[model samples]
Every structure is written in structure tokens, then in C-alpha cells.
Target: MHRQSVAARARQALQSKPRASQHRKTRGRVALSNNHRAFRHELHYITRGGGRPVILVHGIAASHSEWGHLIPDLAACGYHVYAPDLPGHGNSPKPGDAQYYQVESLLVQLETWIESLNLQEPPLLIGHSLGGYLGLAYARDHSGEVRGLVLINPLYSPRQLSPVLNLMRKRPQLGEKALRATPKWVIQALVHLDPSAATQFSPQIRQQIAADYKRASPNIVYLTQSLPDMTASLPLVKAPTLVIWGEKDLSLNPASFPELVKLLPNAAGCPIAGCGHQPHLCKHQEVNRLVLEFMNSAAVAR
Candidate 1:
């Protein structure tokens, strides 16, 4: 009953927004595949360009569209990029079951997505925030299958939460209800609290984000609830890795960057000055250069 009400409200809110046709067209095409047997749903992804494969994963409450700036840049540089909306976000089908939002479930879906594509070699994996956490987990379990990894402002553990979020973490049912009932403006305000996040997007991308949040709010809540300690997997990842962090990231503990670098035997760190959590979007040019450099170096090492 409550879920239905929330869905109804979201649909109403979505109806009030400008149609997708009003915005600039997306560069990538939406492709669907049913390669993952564990989940009985087709995976939706945006794939563009053709060359060395690069799989881009987005963070919580975001879709593949989050890579709007970096996708074309990567494709222009001779890399075939695949950015999936994950399971419960973007154009992908969202299941009502909370189990679908678990970190382990997302990792399995990623592995299956790769297998379905049947790449000649392990493609490079680049993830931001929760996506970064998922990428690390995938690299650790299937070390040889990944060419390299790039983590941009990755979240390894629970972020320092506010009183409301802390309460939400403790009482997930209440959190879900609250998130479902919250207005889009409220959510957007919270997201844009970090000035960098607000300045990173153009007006078009901002609209897309607002829509994504409306649909993926429940998934976001669940993901926050399932935040796990990623420290255990850090030592096990054998893939060449690059950890890029925003110098002024207010979301995750900045101190974790050095500690994360210390854990990975074959990893390097680069901090973007005067940036926040969404460095890939705001500081994309610098981020792209670092990504290209790291990928090129990894290829030479091989």
C-alpha cells in the first residue's frame, strides 16, 4: 500500500517535468540484453565508440547518464565505453525486492554483463563512489579478468551521516518511507549541498538527475543501508589500479585515500585540487587525462 502510494507520487512528479525530447540527445544508444540468469530481467546499457573496451559504472542514485561528460571524451580517444544503469537505476528495470540492491548482487550483475558482451580481453573498469566500491570488489574476485581499475571518489564504508540519515540507517523501513515521501526539490537540495556537485552539470544533465532520483530513491536508500567494509578486498585486487580523489570531498573521509593506496600493491593515487565528490563530472578533463595515462601505462606494463 505504501509502496504503491510512493510510486504513484513519483509518476505524478515525473509527469510534471519536461519530456526527454526537450533535452539534447544522448550520444549513446540504449541496448538491452538478457545474459544474466541470476536475475530475471534484461540489462540496459549505453555503449558507444569502438576500440579498447572500457566499462563505466556510476554511483548511487545515478544512472549511466552520470557519465555524460566523460563518455564522449573516452569514446573520442579510441575507447569503446559501456556504462550500464546497474539494476535498480536509470532505464534498467527496478525490482521491488530489496535483495536486488545489495552490493554482492550488483557485482554479480556486472560480471554477467561482461560475459554477455564476450570481450576479447578483460575490459578496463572505471567506477565512481559506490560504483568504485563495486569495481574494486569485482577486480578482487576476478583479478585476471580486468585490464585495470579507476576509482573516482570511491566509498569504502558508511559515510558520516547526518542525524536524519543516521536514523534512516538504523531504521530502514522508516528511511524508505521517508525517502519515498520526500519531494524532488528536497532531494536535489541535499545532493547539491556540495557546491561541486551543483556546478558539474549543465541544465540538461541536471534534469536527468532529478528524474533519476525520483525513480531510484528506494534503491538509493537500500544501497546506503547495505554499505559494507571494503577494506578486506583491497589487498586482494591484482589489477593495475588508479585511485583518483577529490581534494575537498566532503562525503567520504579523505584520510581513507592514503590508507587505500597503502593497501593496494599495484595502485597509485591522484588528488584533484579544489574539487569535491563528483570530480569525474566537474574535473572531467583532468580526470580523463589521468585515466588515459594510467590505462596506457598499464598496457605498457603488460
Candidate 2:
């Protein structure tokens, strides 16, 4: 009888070993699913890391590749980052229809992308320029869906345009034709007009920018048209917000920074000295530090 009892104990231990192994395998699969899945939407995005999630949005005429330098840094700092190439830019499909360029339509695509990912928690939304404006609109509509927001050199109004752009706006048809007909060199020249923006690009990045410009010219009209709606939605955003601007930013008016902070109920602003429109590219180290700090503080507060 003692021999039989010992045999039974050994059988039980063998069964339990497999159960323990199975549990570990299941845990690993869960982690893999979170960190390695292709998110389908109008945009093509890259996902990395495996911690609290953060969505990075690029500005007008920019793609997910624009965040190339910043993605690895954020991922290493313990955040899962999703950087999407907005429709009509990067590898994403560019539909000629004006409807897809509307702020509301872009918001819909973003909401769908987030839901499809099935994130474990609400994500931090970060945007630059045109993207910043879209992030504000998203936070306003889905207040409970976002933990926090970071807007880098956000475009608040059409009045913020440079003199060259203002002149272009006066002859919309001619401007549109010229943009669509311009050679790639002209597009590159126009894009690099801002010294701060130009200095940030490597040769590879410059090629990508040139290609994006060719495809994105048609979408520019829609971008300007959506400005009024974006401005209208600013006061409604309820998320803890951090607005970072480049002091030397020529893309958007520095004077509007104070007005932007005042428009949001729970928002703060920071200006990076000697930086321009593309802070994440031009002043990545400082931008990353501030972003991490703001996100951590906001997480703790909640």
C-alpha cells in the first residue's frame, strides 16, 4: 500500500509540471500578441516595445518614418509606441477624395485603429503640427479613451501661415496647380525652406520627404480646410495636455502658444530654445525627456 501511494504522488507531480509549463507559454503568447500585430486602418503604422502604449502622429506631408529616431528611444524607456503614417502620406494609401482628408474622417480612422489594436489601457496621444491638431480633436471626442496628450508645434489657425503661404492661399487654384506640377527638386526646396526643419533631415530622410511631398500635394487643400474645425474643438479636450513648441518655430506663430494654453482647461506649455517645427527630429533628446516626464507624472496622478 505504501508503494501504491508513492506512485500516485509521482503521477500528480508529473501532471502539475505540464500545467505550469502551459501557463508560462500562455503568458508569452499574450505578450507577443500585444507587441507584434499589424494594425489595419487607412494608415500604415509601426509598433514596438511592450509597456504602457503611446500613439505617435506625424504632421502634414510627414510619415511614421519621421519618428524614426524617437521611436526606439521611447520604446527603450518602457513604452509601447505606435507611429502611423497618416493617409496620403508614407506607405499608406492616398485617396484622391476630399472626404478622407476631413478632420472628422481622420479621427474616425484613428479611433478604428486604436480599437483594432485592443490596447490593454488608454494610450497617450502625441502629435506634431497637423497631427497635433488632430490629436486635440481626438482627445476632445474620446476624453475617456486617452490618458494624456502631447502637442508639438500644433497648428491652431490658418492665420499662422508664413507670408509665402499667405500669398499662395490668395490664389488657391494657381497654388494647387503649381504644387501638383512642380518637379521633385522644387518640392524639396520648398520643404527645406525652414532652416531648422532642413537641418534635421539625413539624406535618406530627405528622399522620403520628397516622395511624400509629391503624393501629399493634392491633400494640402483639405488640410487647410480642416483648420477651422480643429480650432473649434480645442476647448473641449479634457485630457492632461502638454504643449511643446520650438521658440524659433517658423511653421506656426510662437505668439499663439499662450492663447492655445488658455484655450484648454487642463493644459501647460513648454518652449524649446533654438528649435523649430520639427522638435522631435531637431531636438529629440529634450523632447523625449519632457515627453517621458509628462507621461509619467500624468500616469501617477491618475
Winning candidate number (TM-score): 1
> What is the alpha-carbon lDDT of model 1 when measured against the actual structure?
0.73
Give the worst 10-residue stretch by lDDT in candidate 2: 27-36
Over 93-139, each residue of candidate 1 has an lDDT whose tens digit, in order, gives 88787755666566656665666675766689999988998898777
Consecutive 10-residue window with the lowest summed lDDT within model 1: 17-26
lDDT of 2 by residue, 62-119 (tens): 8887787778988998888988877667777776654445554565455555655767
Q: Which model scores highest in lDDT?
A: 1
Model 2 alpha-carbon drift over 4 Å, by segment: 1-41, 166-172, 197-201, 229-233, 298-302
The superposed Cα distance between candidate 1 and the true structure at residue 230, in angstroms, equals 2.1
**What are the RMSD figures for all models against the true structure?**
10.0, 15.0
Q: lDDT of candidate 2 vs native?
A: 0.70
